[model samples]
Target: MKEVVYNSDLHFEHKQWNSELAFWEDELKTFKNRLSELVTRWTDKEVLAQLEHYQNQFILHGGVIENLQETIEKHETNIAGHSQKGDESMDVALVKKHSEFRYQMEAQRQIYADLKKEFFRFLSKYM
Candidate 1:
């Protein structure tokens, strides 16, 4: 309940309700953290689990890429790591071609970035 003051807008207020506002406020404040946590998340277990799985997969792939990059950098300090498309040795070219060929072949898969990009472009055009 609100107290009436002459200067306040409730100066001519109805005094039907009692002083319960403070009690309610205190009660709600006490559950603030738990209530907020309950309200902010997905309630559907299946959907939530699916989303979590997708996120985990994305993170896993990202971590694999990070590891591969770090190893490549480390090896690049050695002779084998420094090889490119046109080095003097056929071994260097063979190594480069093999890695590139595998990646090129894998690019045909659904998960390939360029294929996904093209799909999105097509979707944007028609949709």
Candidate 2:
């Protein structure tokens, strides 16, 4: 249990998270393009409605991914600064904050995965 709460290097975690977010950001473009193709191929009202729903979701999650990326970048900068200055109190607080961010990233990834699965299921049905 104690090990679960400990991270030896938050910088590595941040790097990993940033890489994943970047991948998702790129994948989102592909998803949007595929959705566009679906729109052109299928004109049924129900299909359009579902497409719109996914479009909105993609847009929303895109913004979320950007925000998280910005946040992680800023935190990484802060971590570097702290390392140079050696502020123990600030380091402690930052570690606590990093844990929260870790939780948030995990949750967001799970949600994104679910969205992708549902999107694929829709494609299988209509495409």
Candidate 3:
């Protein structure tokens, strides 16, 4: 039988960075648990070392996701400030801010997608 990777997106809206972050965190935790279980049953030094490497990469990416969450929150707050100014006439600055926020979020999401893709490939092939 062949194994396939699973991809999910639970964001109901474009601004749901919080939930998007949680999804990545959950994936890492699950992968860590599975790796630990697999390691206990492995007797080969080479394979154990490889699993350890994956664990370290997972930790690093976990920190990256946390930073992305903070950035998204900051952008949302800044946009909110401009929004509270009311729908006045000609707020070019506000529009620019919103556009930048959306762009940042989209870029972050792509980074996360690549990270998760490699992580799952490791899981399906080794664990």
Candidate 4:
């Protein structure tokens, strides 16, 4: 039997995911600022190379976050349309999409977490 997914449940899940993404976006800003400060304080060739690498990674990650945000916004709009049309629960396709998004978000979170750990370990050397 197909599980019923109400609009309320989808909204709640999207909200939670949006909140997490926002937090990660803010953290990236903080990390970038710290990197700027570190660059200003030191000019060792190796350290500068590592810093540049992280800067690029953060930029890439930021783009990914933006893309995710836009995708979610579109999905929310779709949900709103369904609500307006009086759909009490998601269709199978919508349910599958949501499940796929959930998995994608989990993967992104893990990848970002690993990057954060690596960045911090590098900071430990000079900070």
Instruction: Highest TM-score: give the candidate number.
Output: 4
Structure candidate 4, residue pairs in collision: none
Instruction: Indicate whether candidate 1 or candidate 3 has the larger lDDT.
Output: 3
- List lDDT for all candidates, in order: 0.38, 0.86, 0.66, 0.93
**3-57, model 3: which lDDT tens digit per residue?**
3211111112324767877887998898889889879988889878878887887
Candidate 3 deviant stretches above 4 angstroms: 1-14, 87-121
Report the backbone clash tally of model 3.
Answer: 0
Candidate 2, residues 17-124: lDDT per residue as tens digits? 999999999999999999999999998999999999999999999999989998898887787676667642344567778878999999999999999999999999
User: Mind sharing the TM-score for model 1?
Assistant: 0.37
| Candidate 4 ranges with C-alpha deviation above 4 Å | none
lDDT of 1 by residue, 1-127 (tens): 5322221111111121112223323433433433334335656676455445444544454444444444443434333332333332334443454356336335423353553354346335423
Per-residue lDDT of 61 in model 4: 97
What's the CA error at residue 40 for candidate 4, in Å? 1.0
Ranking, lDDT, top scorer first: 4, 2, 3, 1
Poorest 10 consecutive residues by lDDT, candidate 1: 9-18
Could you give candidate 4's per-residue lDDT for residues 1-127 as a string of tens digits? 7668898999999999999999999999999998998999888999999999999999999999998998889889999999999996889898899899999999999999999999999989878
lDDT of 4 at 99: 92
Q: What is the C-alpha RMSD of each candidate to the true structure, in Å?
A: 29.8, 3.0, 10.7, 0.8
Off by over 4 Å in 2: 1-8, 86-90
